[model samples]
Target: MKQFRLHKVASVCLIAAMALIGCSSQGGEKAAPGTQPGASEGSGQQVTLSMHSWRVEDTEGYKAIIQAFEAENPNIKIDFKPFKATEYNTILNTALQSDSGPDILQLRPYAPGISLAEAGYLEPLDNIAGISAFPKDVLAAATGKDGKVYGVPLSLNSTQFFYNKKIFEQNGLKEPKSWDELIATAKTLKEKGIVPISFGAKEGWLLSLSHGVIAPASYSGSGYIDKLLKGESNLQSPEFLQSISRMQELIPYFPENYVGLELNDMRTLFATEKAAMFINGSFELEGLKKLNPDLQLDFFPMPTNDQKAVITTWVDGSYAVNAKSKHKPEALKFMEFMATKKFGELFANQFKRISAVPGVSTDDPLVNKMAELSQSSSTPYLMVVHFAEGKPTTKQALENALQGMYLGKLTPEQVAEEIQKSAATWFPPFKK
Candidate 1:
């Protein structure tokens, strides 16, 4: 009877939903609160909380985590919902606006999450237990402009190149340590009839993610974005514009009709051995493995023009509680569990992601190597984080400019000017 009761409770909380707003799936609507199989006979009612995240691939991994959490907190049940990355923000924003949002949500760290917090959609997590143990910089990445703690980071990820080890060996090439060497290496690979890189610009937003990894190392390492935020740097500056032009120079080595392809297609091109390298975040390792379990891969810091490479690192994702959640205590409980070292280890072990907790480290050597590279990460992709929070966001503006460039409709200068102009309402120098 006890076993059956536990299963019932799990079912209530772990219901899979296709659409977040409706909370309905192909399996039908979830069991309503208070009437679920394990609902208390009187005062101790069962509470089911929905957690929406963008990691659809991590669903099974999170289920294992959820099961562990359920065993400890029997009264509260958690349902994990996943969404496509490209459409996640739009769906989540819409849900929050309509008061139909989940109890917990995966937030894009920094400016994007802060924008929601400022709009009063997210709960302040100041009182959550063990939150103080998190690294200050990681915590600050999820903090709102108002100084309130809005989320707890899920993992640290950096944008870098994942190169095929076998491909490098076959070509007798060593990993490039400088920008010039990187170009020369790519040129050599192209001459050998191998696609040097797998990149997809069809979605447009990839320009931000891809370039965010390169721009910092190329221009001024981590200090560049900081300067841009402080009005010390602007998109029109030669250093910043040079990064854009550099991307153009390297474009020829990418898969043909690269802009017409999607990320999955590009990954396929890499996985099948047609491409020698793929630039993405550390989070992509698991997906890449699934595509080709035997494909040997390793990573290197994004090379810089001056040879002093800097990795682009930041708190990639965080979990925020919904301000309007009906079950705040339960939501807090789950988030508190997320902060525990036990949960951190579980997350890293299961998902192969680096934990945000101070003492926790991923057991995976590659993940640890990625962490080592982060020590040099200072400049983040600010337009994605801070500058473009309102009006035409820096991300949107920049991607449009990049798309225009891809189509040969705009020069690098014109693209930069368009980005500045697009962000004019929000960027200080361009404002009236």
Candidate 2:
């Protein structure tokens, strides 16, 4: 798995009770004492270091790089544990609670990391030498209220609208530039029996992202985002509603099992040619191309009501060391290697996503277009349901609302109420 190959996202029915990551890590070469000034003093000090990361199936892809690290530092060996995509978050939390977890972890920025940071599972990064080179915005992201950095963001992957070039050409359609065009295109695709949009709203968070980033950015104008951030505006403003209303109107244009799909399933449907377009982050490009090398995939800015569409950035992966790790310095060294310009290019060019580091040319024609369209991205971890105890609530409310809307159980006004309730809980103002 060269890129993120999240094969399938199983039903979230058991999400409440299930621990994430079904794979157990075992059977890797182990050694120790080959690293650090003092650790190396003991010639045969064996440290069978095991670590956990989300979606660990990238064994073969990470092979070359990890092997190089191991070869250079002979005494330290790494036992890599891969997490199943569907169960990663829950399992990672469980592992982090116990002292027996992996020494390092791959964390999501907009999720429930504050709990772990406060629990003292994560190490601070203020003194890390290479911290300055990381994306400034993303660097700010890993900083928690405890005044310590919980992680180091590796790449910034923005979300957008992915449409099939061949399909657009065959239908004599151009990429939509405004909300009206998007709706018109959906209507056209519907007549051809193609699902125009593919989002697993049944999973809730994916649907929220579409509504949160694309909808708001398109209708209210970019200034609206800053206003909301400054508390001059709230999500329930007319602009957000207008954009969300347009998104909701497309319920009839998605796949048949829209009520039963999740993120990975929706991507598979698009990759297998079951849908004409998909809206998602950049992590999927490599795996998508692998499935169909000649698919002619091109993404365009999500059509907003505004003349200029604003890009919402989501930094995909963040790396953090364990607070209790005996080898903190080496871990920072690894973080340094990951933050360099070299890693940024490897990430962007390798994964076909936006890079977080400065000075990295997204000069490749396709990547350049994505970069050009990405105006700016900000950090707001305090909001977004995927962040904490708030997720289950959002998932329930959103899943119920969308599923109800699709099934004609809920009215538009009713659905709006349920979403607003959740947003309020997640975005309450600081009371200092």
Candidate 3:
């Protein structure tokens, strides 16, 4: 029942924002990093920079975030084009090929940078900010095979188990420290007329978020997805099947009608006190808090079998420079601001995620707990969140496979086999 939550987990979009004054500032656009702004040195004429995104609810928070940057530097204007994930991707894939489109938008690291870089459509950004201190995985996600960086990560996070504090204490149970303990505790709660785990199985990302997403890390035996992506290993193998089998063992522990539950169901089960535990990302803290601010919370990194603890992580976040925008310089300056602690403090406090910048803190005790759990990993392994739906051809097939697995229609071996088949045809080309 510990499944992924979408309202809490962010998907890829083409995210971009301009650092202009409150809709009035003007200046030459900022550059991404490795390349100069692809415009005349200084053009002040109506540079209405637009960026597309699938994050609608988060826009207000992000707007507040960008406003702080805008207050500090009032030169470039930003127009946010917001849409749901599905619509945004559909429009974006089409827009990237058209003349009229956003300067930046949200995208998964491998898909956006790698594919676009291969197409020779993305502008390199290594020269401008010189983000030398940036974490290697963050830098790696942005860089194409040619070693050109196309974007920067705005936040760093790892998916973990988020469970009810009251439930554990009431059941005379401690938060589980091992897979066996988890099963024992969940059984105790379920027998008491309380579901032990809550999750949104209806969403494909949730399945991927909780289980399918970590195939590369588990299969490679390297214990990290970022490492596998760096030519460290192959994905279509039995080691990955081992991880999928582990998840399958827990299906009996999920709600009896688990397949009937949709994307928000499991989260709702926990939020309403019907379930004792849930597994999701730190981003869910905001919504979970809004429902019950006193919701006592704690997190444990996803379990491991003989291997070290691993967390499925998304190494990329929304925000990219347009390859054709006139206000590139101004946009990048704002991005620099985003890369600062001030920006992290302003935006990351509520989502409960750890900031990528050097310094930022939250008074919330739970966020600190998740951060503490992640300290064991070298750099957060971004590979656990291997994006299967890299393009239109693969997205639907992967989604169907996820749905089939949830319904018991597909066994772990079958799930692994189907995904393995897609991996050959679906792995998009690296950037040019």
The candidate that wins on lDDT is 1
| Candidate ordering by TM-score (highest first) | 1, 2, 3
Q: How well is each residue in 137-246 modelled by candidate 1, as lDDT tens digits?
A: 56766664344577888887778888999999999989898888889999999999999999888987678888787776557664555555456767787877887887
Ranked by lDDT, top first: 1, 2, 3
> Over the stretch 48-88, how does candidate 2's per-residue lDDT look in tens digits?
45656775545554555456556655656667777876578
lDDT of each: 0.74, 0.60, 0.57
Error of 3 at 237 (Å): 5.6
For model 2, the local distance difference test gives 0.60
Candidate 3 per-residue C-alpha lDDT over 205-320 given as tens digits, one digit per residue, 9 for 90 to 100: 56666653234234432343433344344344567666677667667667768877764677677787777777776677777777777777666665455445555555546366
Q: Over 4 Å off in model 2, which ranges?
A: 1-38, 41-48, 56-59, 362-364, 376-400, 423-426, 430-432
Q: Which of the two, 1 or 2, has more lDDT?
A: 1
TM-score of 2: 0.81
Once superposed on the true structure, which residue ranges of model 1 sit more than 4 Å away at CA?
1-44, 428-432
lDDT of 1 at 194: 96
Tell me how many clashing residue pairs each candidate has: 1, 8, 30
